[model samples]
Target: MTTRTILAAAALALVPALASAECGWEKRINANTCGEGQTFDTATGTCVDQSTS
Candidate 1:
């Protein structure tokens, strides 16, 4: 294949990957309902004290 054709194919292949890629940070608009001064811990899947965190 020609150099230009190879480059075009490579660019086309990357189009879907770039389009499907998730960009930007996720924001939590609402606060966690795990009581006062407590946050939800993903590791243990429970509310943990803020002091320890």
Candidate 2:
């Protein structure tokens, strides 16, 4: 393949790989919830306290 053709194909392949990730959260809430210092959990699908662990 020509050099230009190879470069074009490479750029096209990277377009989708660098695209933004979706919501990333496992769930969503309806009403205004989460107390003064809490947040939603993305893995277990619940709202709970924030922890670095």
lDDT of each: 0.73, 0.69
Q: Write the per-residue lDDT of candidate 2 for residues 1-53, one digit (tens) a residue.
A: 99999999999998876663435443456325666557867666556876867
Using all chains and alpha carbons, the TM-scores for the candidates as numbered come to 0.42, 0.40
RMSD of 1: 6.9
Question: Model 1: runs farther than 4 Å from truth?
Answer: 23-53
Which whole-number lDDT from 0 to 100 does residue 50 have in model 1? Answer: 86
Clashes of each: 0, 0
Candidate with best lDDT: 1
User: Taking the tens digit of each residue's C-alpha lDDT, what string does model 1 give over 1-53?
Assistant: 99999999999999988776644344332336588887788776677778952
> Considering summed lDDT, which 10 consecutive residues are worst modelled in model 2?
22-31
Q: What lDDT is obtained when candidate 2 is compared to the true structure? A: 0.69
Off by over 4 Å in 2: 21-33, 36-53
